[model samples]
Target: MDSGETKISLKDAENEEKEQFKLLHKYEAEVPKTFEEAISETGFGRFNYTLLVVILFPCATQMVETVGMTYIVPVAECDLHLTIEDKGLLNGVTFAGMISSGLFWGYLCDALGRKKIIVYGYLVTGFFSVMAAMSTSKGMLMGAKFMSGLIMHLSKSKAVLIPIIIFFLFVEFHAWNVFMLICASMTIISGILYMFLPESPKYLMSMGRNRAALVVMRKVYSKNTGKPQEDFPVKKLVNEAKQNFTSSRVEMATALKSGWEEMKTILHRPHINNMILASFNAFSIVMSLNTLKFWLPGIFQSISDYQNNHNGTSSSMCVMLGEMSKPKNITSSQECSVVKFHAWNVFMLICASMTIISGILYMFLPESPKYLMSMGRNRAALVVMRKVYSKNTGNPQEDFPVKKLVNEAKQNFTSSRVEMATALKSGWEEMKTILHRPHINNMILASFNAFSVVMRQVFSSLLVILTFISATCMFCIYFARSSLAVTILSAAGTAVGSVPENLLLTITLELFPTTLRTIALSIHLTAQRFGTTLGNAIFPYLVQMGCLPPFLFIGIFASATGLLSMLYANTENKPLI
Candidate 1:
């Protein structure tokens, strides 16, 4: 009888355990799956637009340094007495600096934060740019250029800088030293403006500073919706902070150790292959873009020289500024030539001034929420989501689903540390993930596309040169005339080469998960720098072999990149996984 009673009791306990598990699962199901869903409820608002514009400023500055250098070579050639090798060295030196520092910067940005690196980068880059401007000799300028590249972050400074340089060159302000100084001043102003900008809320949360991230969100909400900060989600954020810590108290040393291990995860599984593909893409793009950008001025000079000789025209036709309207300050009877200090300085000043204004305006921009969530700063991430929703709909904080967001944070982040540990331990698994299915094919395709694009650009430029050379040799019977045709062909090739530059980051970003995003980007950028350095070194030597070989060699790389593109998955419109 006693034995029978004990058996019945055991059956009852099993039933109780099953019921409790059912209840737990039901509760979890009610929670939201991800932070992005909450963020989507926040209407895309002016704040986002403003952020984009602000971010674009750095891009402009980056462009200025990169593309502007090419323009500087020809104009400064007389002043600095640069040879062909010197010009190639100038073009490639900055990339070398970038290669050395890109991985380091990426690692820091991932481990520490993005804002600090970006702000500091601008300051250091500007300082070096000033050094370059004040350079008295070729060696000084080359050193300055390399340092500038090493310190500077990537962006789209070329578009504006190019026009400005051309205009200045046209106006007889071709002195590279003064132009560089002007660029440096603008960069410094930009850095100062970055100081006022808010840290990325995502970065803060990743560091487990949910409350601070929440505070940032509240400020953004208040600024956008004109609402009082009285009804803040303090409870939600507090819970999120709690969830981020696996232990009630993790030591700083332990956390940092974890973070280091976390960085090493990029080399594992799905991420490793992605990293490789991204790096190769970067290499291909940088090679093509820098090769063209750095060589444009030299090509133009060659063309101008050829035309001047063949046409027996004392006036120039091939220079960018020469084609534009001359300033009224110069007499109509005065001979127009590439002046050492053109009115283009005013344009450079204007461009720099505009970038400064943008930097100041961007101070209002917030951090990326995805980055925040990855760091297990769910509460902070939620706050940003709420702000997004509130700003878009002009609604009070109460209207949003705060509890659901909290639940999602709890469920998703409950094992964040465990996941990190898993990622660190299962590096091979991650690699396997990347090597299979959609990712593998995509990587293969993208790599080939990149290879082909670069190769085509290089090959086409050389081919164009050859085609023009043969045509001119057969018809015009003058080497100088052939030089002008080849130079123009080079310009066209450069234009083609740069056309695909804007797509690199977009595609790479969409492919990688948030956890590996920054590191992947760093790897990509580093590879690109390497490629650029190689191209710069090789292109000059190839040109020495009489132009045709350079294009053929470039064509081979382009063909490879292009073939890779065939396998590239359309990441466009796909959500980040």
Candidate 2:
């Protein structure tokens, strides 16, 4: 009778445990689950103190640096006595420094953690900002800028910086946008470094420390934020801790080391193919964004110019200056600096507004579901999915709790070796399937090569044609319009020549995991920054050579980017968190 009673008691406890899990799962998601829900449920109000502080502050600091760097273009021409050609070279060199250090910093951050990486970026960048200001020579400035590149927090920095850079041209003239970004980036970096910053919750959970993940999540997500508890499961988490036991899930000292493990999992029949697919996507996205960003401002300004000319209106701002305001009158160094300061300020603001719009788009994009699922956060993934997808489509017949999945992976699979083998086999099988999927990768690569050949041939002759176009236009416009129109047009042209297009961030979020996103962006942007440096460096020489058509390089880079974009699968409406 005692044995019977003991068995009954044990069974009762198990049932109770199951019931608790069910309750926890029932409240799947409380935060903004849909577009309408975002305003009400997101960190919309100041109540979610932590969320607002973290997200907004980092963004602000990043923008300031971007605005400062981009504004350097206008300033460089005057402060360093740079010709229009020299301006391009300086920008390109600074960007090249950024590209060179990106992967290195990314690896370090992944190895160490986000907190240290971000704080370091602040300290280093802030210090360099002062250094850049103090430099007496162009060489000195270049060295200081390179040092700034060395210290960037690859992943954390990019999320904030990318938007700012993209909008640098638009906001170059807008003070408000520049102010907002600078404030936001500063707030994020400072707040997180000083206090209350928790490490990535998903990273913690992946290593089987469910309790640790819970504690961090609670600390990170304040009650005031109105975020769903489903995003952070206590009992469900405790349950998941039991299931992921294997040689594969062991903890390591650094997340970078973990990345190596992930790479192993990533490669093989399925993941390898996906990695290749991702690589191609990355190649296209990065190249495209870089090229287009370099040329966007020019295109936009050109359009404005065309419209003005068609309407027979004058546009150059320089020619409209007061008769007393001659180069001789503005000979003082301070005067030139003042002009540059004002010019950059206005340009950064326009770009800042556009960047802010992009940020809003990011908020709408959902986080990576595969990442959560891999980490055994099915319940949370489900909640995020509901928020992102439930209203329209792919809503499961009903909420399939994490407990059900966990039990199957642990109990049903443990007794069945065949099932375990199936899971192991699936990883590699997926890779093979991808490569064979119409073999599109090879075809695209070939096409790009062919395209490059044709382009090079045309570009050789096109240079002369471009020079003719610029000379004719400059002749007609300079003489045909009033001085005021000339100044208006120059301002207009600068605007067109600098704005980064939409493809950069859009492709990044779509192609990479939350974990890998920043690194991927760093690599791509690094390439872009280097390309910019080259353009900046070589452009002045090209201009001096007589064509004065500085925009051709920008156009070439953009075309290359577009062509590469065709190699990857379109991420246009695809989910990117």
Candidate 3:
């Protein structure tokens, strides 16, 4: 009787434990999973590697479009009847477009969607690029280039030397138009490729399309894991949308009001100082980099011209510039013409083809899960993460451990549209705030730095080591005995100068809160483009003044900015706000 009672008790305990596990599993099924929990389930895999490859094309095309003009200006000078001033205008016009359009594009990217703007923007930019290639007159070309810059504001540069090599190898045969067409074609290809890409999962969630975002994540998981969508572990996701805007139409008044509020937040106390520092640094670096870079080929061409005419004779940069500035008469017999099978034409074609390939490949990339989390679409974000986990670890989705994620701050906004006049009034009020007290001081400092960096032509030895090296190199170029020495020193200066441009941008990114980061960067880029435009516009005048003026201008500004950089608080391990 005792043995029978013990057996019965053990059986009952075992049954009770099994029943409890069943209840736990059922409860888990009903609970919504967080983005972190979902994403943790997905492992790293082939999809990530593929996404990286696709991103490379747009980057390459941007470089080609911006810097290609540097090469073309030199070769096309005779054909286009370009003077020193005309060359400066052409080189700087692209940046002028960028400066004007940066904020506009940023606004659209947020309101519409990043992928949409990028896609349509690239397509339109390509058309403008083609217009630039076909332009017969200086004004027409400038207009076209400006348009290209306006549309192509999204993307930058260590690969400065590529166009120089390309020009040398190809400009001997083909006209500049062919190269422009090649760039245009690349933009078109990038646009087409962008069509296949999914909208940002975060953007979808922000718009209250949780189910759509989930579908996208499921697709990504399928691609990454080669698994059926039905096999995904999570049966449902948590809804995180804070506002549901019902209207498809967006009013300018509404947009303006919304934008003004965001701008006020960015211009507020804590971020103002960093913004000022970044803007100044951007202006200094871009002005120095582009002004010199745009004119480098011209300098080299002048040197080549002198060597050809004065066989075996050596001269300084100042002497060459002075000689080139003197008037020369051209005869009808000197008419410019294009040659066949040019190397530049071929190289541009190759670049365009690669861009197309990258665009096409980019279709496979998934929306960023982190961006999703930021938008409070934790469930959608988790789905993306799980896909990644499944692909990376080659594990069954159900076997993934994490079942929940922490909730994040959700985006909230009012749906009621305001009148245009009210929006304008509000915007003006916000703008006025930046003109006051603490903000005003930093703004003045930034302006002063930009003005001094662009207008003053001087150099000093006391600065950061790299900038010092760059200054020393510039000084050395004036006294360089051989073409090779000038080439080496100029190249060294250019490479060294690029380091600070990247560093300043990186620091700027780390200095602001997520809400203000994009705006700060936009301001930073606008300052950079302004610097580029002003520097290039003035460079020819400086050259006319003397070679030393231009070199001194670049070297001095570089050093001054380098010194200013020392004052920035260290951000190495600082957490993002």
Candidate 4:
């Protein structure tokens, strides 16, 4: 009887142990996963390195397109019959196109999908770029370049100096068309390669295609991990679509309506002040940077011209520019003088090929998992994270810690179409918001600061006259006896000038909330582009008016803006909303 009792007790204990095991498994299965938790599992490795390489194509292409004209202007002056004003127009036109189409592109990116827009946009830009290369007349080139800018928005960087060096080496070729062709080819290659890239999983989820998003993630996992599709850990995805919005289709009308509503929200209280300030700062910095940058090749060319004619003469930037302002007699018999630099073609070719190579490699990239989470495709995001983890750690996908994802859909809106009248009205309201109350002072300060910075570039020569200005090295540029000294001073100025922009951008980022950060940045970029356009457009006229006017004009503005910066609220250590 005692032996029977012992057996029965042992059996009961075994049963309880099994039940506890089942309960533990159930809890583990039901545990929800957050995007951050899911993504943390993916360690950075081979996938991230590949992504870094691929994204560089867009950046390279943008540099080639926007500044490519600057290189051409100096060499093509004879062929294109370009004047100072015409050069200004050529440089500024692209930005004008960008500004005009900025909102439209933003809406289209939402409606169509980022991948679609990027691929097709690049192809169209390449076509226009080729057209620009083939243009015999200024008007045709201008139109082509403008169209390129209108279509191409994925474009900036310090790497601009690399192209400058390349152009310098290649300037002797005097093959402006060839240069343009190179730029076009780079853009086209990028567009073609973009075709092989996966669409944004977030966009798919936004359109109520969570399963499609998951499929993309799984493919990414397989590629990153060198594993079969069947090995991907996550098999199920949560539905991210709103109950009433079950369709997987997105219309232009829907996008526009949503965009306009979002724009309105961005322009309202709490955001207005930050936006205005940020925009103004962006305009100033970009304008200053581009105005000087676009004209740099021309400036160097003029210096070369001056030095060639008067070999022993040492002069200031004003002297070179002053000589450039003087009218010249040109005859049909006069040969088009090209800069005779060595190995320029090779460098330019290298720069061009780099873009193509980056594009081709871009084929290996996957959709952004962060975007997936935003679209409420948590499961898809988790899969991507797992792939990243396995690739980074050389582990199996099943070993990924997170098993299920928590829905984190942030975008929810109801709208069908947008009307032209509504767009205009909303734009006006946005402007009003920017100009209203506490924000107005911020705008004024930012605008003044921007204006000041650009003016500083224009009157950089004014360092000679303003004894109070602390930049003694800049003052030395005017007095420098040798080319080497002048070069050093100029390099120093370039390095120092870059600092203010970084500070202002950081401040802008710190002052705004994450929700409005992108819009604020957009505002900043738009303003910066506008500044570039305005500065380039006016720079030629300023040069023509006389060296002193440009200097004085910029000097006073810079001085005033420097003071205005004093009133700006300190952004240091301030938490973003």
What is the per-residue lDDT of model 1 for residues 141-260, given as tens digits with 9 covering 90 to 100?
A: 888888787764345443444554443344333457677777777677667667766787666665566666666666555554445454333323322333434322344565566557
lDDT per residue for candidate 3 within 1-577, as digits (tens), equals 9999999999999999999999999888757765556554444444555566656668877897788888888777766777888889999998888877776765576567778887888877876776677666778889889988876434432142365344446344345777777777777777876776677766666556667767767766666565756656765666655442432324556667766877788777877777888889889877887887878788777787787779858687677766556543545315654444455566667676777677566556667888877666677777777867877997756566877777763546223333564688799667656543576778889998886455223222223566667767765677775668878988988888886777678778878878777778778888998998999898888888887788889888887778877767655435678
C-alpha lDDT values of all predictions: 0.61, 0.47, 0.72, 0.67
Itemize residue pairs with steric clashes in candidate 4. Answer: 42-389, 43-389, 169-344, 170-344, 284-450
Which ranges of candidate 4 are over 4 A from the true structure?
1-43, 152-174, 242-246, 249-273, 339-486, 551-562, 572-574
Give candidate 4's whole-model lDDT: 0.67
lDDT of 1 at 198: 77
At residue 31, give the lDDT of candidate 2.
22
Candidate 2: minimum summed lDDT over ten consecutive residues — where?
A: 318-327
When summed lDDT is taken over every stretch of 10 residues in candidate 3, the lowest stretch is 454-463
- TM-score, model 1 to reference: 0.57
Ranking by TM-score: 3, 4, 1, 2
Score candidate 1 by lDDT. 0.61
Error of 2 at 246 (Å): 15
Taking every candidate in turn, the Cα RMSD to the unseen true structure, in Å, is 16.4, 18.4, 17.9, 17.4
Q: Kindly give the stretch of ten consecutive residues in candidate 4 with the minimal lDDT sum.
A: 462-471
Better of 2 and 4 by TM-score: 4
lDDT of 3: 0.72
**What TM-score should be assigned to candidate 2?**
0.46
